[model samples]
Target chain A: MFLNLFLLLAAVLCAFQAIRARQMLAAALWLACTSAIVAWLLYALGAQEVAVIELSVGAGLVTILFVFGITIAGEEIQEVGSLVPWAVAGGIALALIGLVAWFVLPAQEASTAVSEPSFSVMVWENRGLDMLVQIGLIFAGVLGILGILAEKETAEEQARASQKTPTSTPPLPQPQVITTDAHQDTPIKEAHA
Target chain B: MSSELTITAVTVLCLLGVALYGLLIVRNLFQVIIALQILVKGALIALVLAGKISGQINLGQSLAVTVIVADTIVAVVGLALAVQVKRYTGSLDVKNLSTLRR
Candidate 1:
């Protein structure tokens, strides 16, 4: 009972934070949290395989990707936009949420009949192709990173520019000094005396 | 209430939810990543709990292994992005990243 309450509270908290946050990064975080909670709920519902995928792909990889994209693309806000659009969007979303909740409430609590192999075996062994596709997706991501880090003609251009620049001042010439004996100067001084 | 696994599963879900919320609401990229980590952990917990309830060792082990891989993938990607952000903007705050904004 307590755990259930905690889950409920966490879900509520994540939703509230996601809705109220103004920053894009913050919104992304809240979204990740929401997905995580849903993943856990899925597990509790006995869909362990689905839960793992949800957590890994949705919460972990997706969140990082989102942050990466946001950072790469820049998430800065130049101005505070009007709230009119926000209100409309919120209203529509809330209405849809209410409708879905009402529709699913009856079946939401209904326990699924536990199968022999369960959903786990089905996703893993039966859907190996999907897993292969997922691996490909990861490989694509790595390639994308490599593409970003690849240095192009920019470095060469910089080097050429430095080579072409002229020197501001000529190098200082070395000073030449003739060595004179101190004893010779003393003899001249004595003759003068 | 019914079983330890069930209770744990529910708790994990709630934690995941909270982490997601944090990820969405926080403006700081670091905070978002942290929230994402929490969310991932919650999901892992849920998977493990389900494995326990079902009495299937193979499913649980495989699921755990996959989750770990996913975790590593996310961490690597997230670190790379974080470094890139720092390199470009000199700050991790998303609000400061308006160079590409139209």
Candidate 2:
């Protein structure tokens, strides 16, 4: 009971910091901490597989990606001061919604019928297609991200080539593709501009 | 007072509300992303609680795994897009990009 309360308190505090911290980098770190705590909460609640994945991907990989975002963009935008107004307004609004939901939502009852199925049946037979589709979705998402990043890199290379190859003086053949995207459109551009 | 009453689920849902408020009001891309992550966490907690109550732990685990996968995918693609946006616009501020047409 005390552990659950402690987890709840930790989660709330971290969530606030994650949302309201002035520096994006700081916010990202706070978010990582929040993810770690949530994973712990899941573990305590007996959702071991969920907790492990949350620990690794949510806390681990996402945090790394967020740090990369900060480094790449590297523009520091300070947080707006004073959480009072936002907090009060948000809390009140949420409370009102919850009040409404409590009455409107149907009461759920725990199933009294306990038919024990083996873990293998639950996983392989019942959930095979579900897992298969999820794997495919994640795989496709990864490929999409890679393709997007690659496109940006090639665009940068083309822009550089355009810069180096001068026209008229040497009469080098006109480059085929136009300005890869825009000199002004990317993070590297921020450095030069 | 009943053990069957899901007070914990309510608490988790309240946390989701807090995260949702942040998501709605915040313009900072990173903060919004954090808010979104919190929201996902809240949902995962609620799912676990529901499964526990319904005596369907395996079903809940399976659903939680799906949510985790979806959350990861969104986190990745969303951050990448945010980076791409920053690259083109030279600012991380979401309001700065006003174009409706591609």
Q: What TM-score does prediction 1 earn? A: 0.46
Positional deviation of A171 in candidate 2, in angstroms? 12
Look at candidate 2 and give me any clashing residue pairs. A185-B87, A185-B88, A186-B87
> What are the per-residue Cα lDDT tens digits for candidate 2 across B17-78?
76877866677677777888888888888777767667776677778888888888888888
Tens digits of lDDT, candidate 2, A1-193: 6677777778888888887788888888888898898888878777787788889998899999899888887856745543336767687658865884575245465659456465457666788887898989899898989988998999799999998988667854543433465665642322221
Q: Against the true two-chain complex, what DockQ does each candidate achieve?
A: 0.12, 0.47
lDDT of 1 at A32: 79
lDDT (Cα, 0-100) at A180 in candidate 1: 68
Please give the distance, in angstroms, between residue B37's alpha carbon in candidate 2 and its true position after superposition. 0.9
Weakest lDDT window of 10 consecutive positions for candidate 1 chain B: B1-10
Q: Per model, state how many residue pairs clash.
A: 20, 3
Show model 2 residue runs off by greater than 4 Å: A79-113, A116-120, A165-193, B1-7, B99-102
